[model samples]
Target: MKLQLLSDLHLETEAFEPEPAPGADLLVLAGDIDATWQGLERFAGWPVPVLFVPGNHEFDGRAVEHVVPALRGLCTRLGIRLLHRESWLFDAADGQRVRFLGAVRWSDFDVFGARERERSMRAAGYFMRLMASTQHGQPFDADAVRREGLACRAWLEAALAEPAAGRWQQTVVVTHFAPSLKSADPRFGRQPGTASFCNADDDLIPHTDVWLHGHLHCRHDYLVARAGRKPTRVLSQARGLVDKGEAEGLDPGKLIEL
Candidate 1:
């Protein structure tokens, strides 16, 4: 099936213009879907099935009580499937099958960097608190960085091990973070790779396929070797609304028949 993948559309409701483009079957919004939940309505009204995941922007690192409910409502209204630490199998146009395992990966400093150790620690704590801040913390330590990794890893492993695994013509991994190590470009600037950004998890190595993510707006496209030891395409389409110049480098509103 023809699918359109986009991310980081820090939504501007007044000027939002996303055409489904003719022949597009499914739409995948990797993350940073919008600047706020207010944009959800318009996104939901799109005439197609959308699969989305939350990006760091979607989280205030406070409580999901705000975003989760709104997202669920939007999904219900728009017929979109929001996956997080979950998997979904989709049928493409050519009878091919694709599975999406979604997650907002934690920063992997071991590979990315140790520069923002203090900030990473704080952010990690905030994330953990947000995860567990609900209930009497019934879920217990929802904010733990280790737990987040485990959850995402568990879901991916299970999805890859499905009994019908070999039945899929090809698989696509939809995540909020980059999955390949090859995307690691430490050659860039002042303190290149100093930001502790772009996470790459060990769990990702095995399920390598197409990693559709949107965290780095400048770093952009990358391809890495994984699983079948083949090139796994990675795309991060996070240009903000004002990026008219950058838009020229992208082919939006087109269906990628993979």
Candidate 2:
């Protein structure tokens, strides 16, 4: 299967009109295509099957309680599959099957170390200020985000362990947040603020074949070692803030073969 990967189009401020690339078996939008949810309509009736995973931006200014239900309804109406803590199977042209597990995977603020969680929390206040999402009839707080992130991690761990998911020809994990610190930009390496952008999901690398994510507004394509298994390929194809042309290593026509 040749899957075209794209993310972080941020169509809220940037202009983009994309069609499924020729010969692509699937089009995967890793998230942040738009926060307002209107940009997603552009993919309606796309030539190939389109799978989307909502990024943090999708909830900004919207109540956390309402953001997902609204997206789910829109996706159902548009024929797009929105995956979050969800699984979807794709039948490849070669008669192979690929299974995808997706989530926004919010940062746990434990990227540095368990001991430094407090420091990471202190350094990152931007999410609360900007997300502006409400939960439990109150503003969503860091603790809530942290709990949700960990819950995603737990769900993924259990999902990957399922025999049914493992029976596919290949397994792929998708998220809006970086799976490992290695996917982070080197310039911000080890910074407390960087904790908000990625996760300490090194433990999960050995459990899956491929991982796709978008959050840092950059790009990455690297292989991570997996014990007694094929090396896991980590990729990000985010377009970032195109108006500023800051998204590095972006390949809009990039395709991954499974």
Candidate 3:
């Protein structure tokens, strides 16, 4: 099936006009479409099935515990599929079946080790503070964020281990956070504060045929090879404005076929 992947639209800053390619079978909103839930309404009338995973921005100024259920209800009402620690099976006209596992995978802060984590805490502590103060007006501790990331990792590991995982001809893993270091902008990899949040651990690399992720606000495509597994294709399409000049020329609306 032809899948149109989009992410980091940040519609509040950059409006999104849904002009899917001809014969586009499905639309995947990887994450960060907008900060407000209402932004999703813009895509309601699209002709194809829509699937989404939440981005970190979706939780901005809102409690994740509350926002998640609300987003699920909104998706149900709008006929959109919200994939959170879940899987969906789609069958193509030609009888090929593909499975999509979706999650808003958070950074485990293990990308660069303890020194980077300390640096991130020192440099980006404001972000953690904002989340703690505003999340449901209850303290959303840093430990909680780390726990959530670990939980997502555990869920993915279990999901891939399931016998059902073997049935699909291909498995596409969708996440808001980059799963591999290669997907992250190389310049940011060693930065003090931003480096930790740019990637997730590479444990999921072996199980994915195609990894769709956002949050970098930059587009990338590369093949990642893991021990005893074939190379996995990783793709990201983000339309948000980036301060880095390297991402200035990327076409955010690019359509990718899987």
How good is model 1 by TM-score? 0.74
Clash count list over all predictions: 4, 0, 0
lDDT of candidate 1 over 1-258, digit per residue (tens): 777888767673325566686788788888776646566566666777788887756664335445556776777777778887777888766677877677766444334445554554554454445444432334323234434545665677677666554766666777766554544434433232323345545445545567777655533565666644667666666554454443445566756666
- Give each prediction's root-mean-square deviation over alpha carbons: 4.7, 1.5, 2.5
**Residue 143 alpha-carbon offset, candidate 3, angstroms:** 2.5
TM-score of each: 0.74, 0.95, 0.89
Let me know the TM-score candidate 2 reaches against the reference structure: 0.95
Alpha carbon lDDT at 58, candidate 1: 68
lDDT (10s digit) by residue, model 3, range 118-138:
565555556677544345456
State in Å the error of residue 2, model 2: 1.0
Index of the highest-TM-score prediction? 2
lDDT of each: 0.61, 0.86, 0.76
Q: Which predicted model would earn the best lDDT?
A: 2
Clashing pairs in 1: 1-92, 1-93, 128-143, 129-143
RMSD (Cα, Å) of model 2: 1.5
The better-scoring model by lDDT among 1 and 3 is 3
Query: Which residue pairs clash in candidate 2?
Result: none
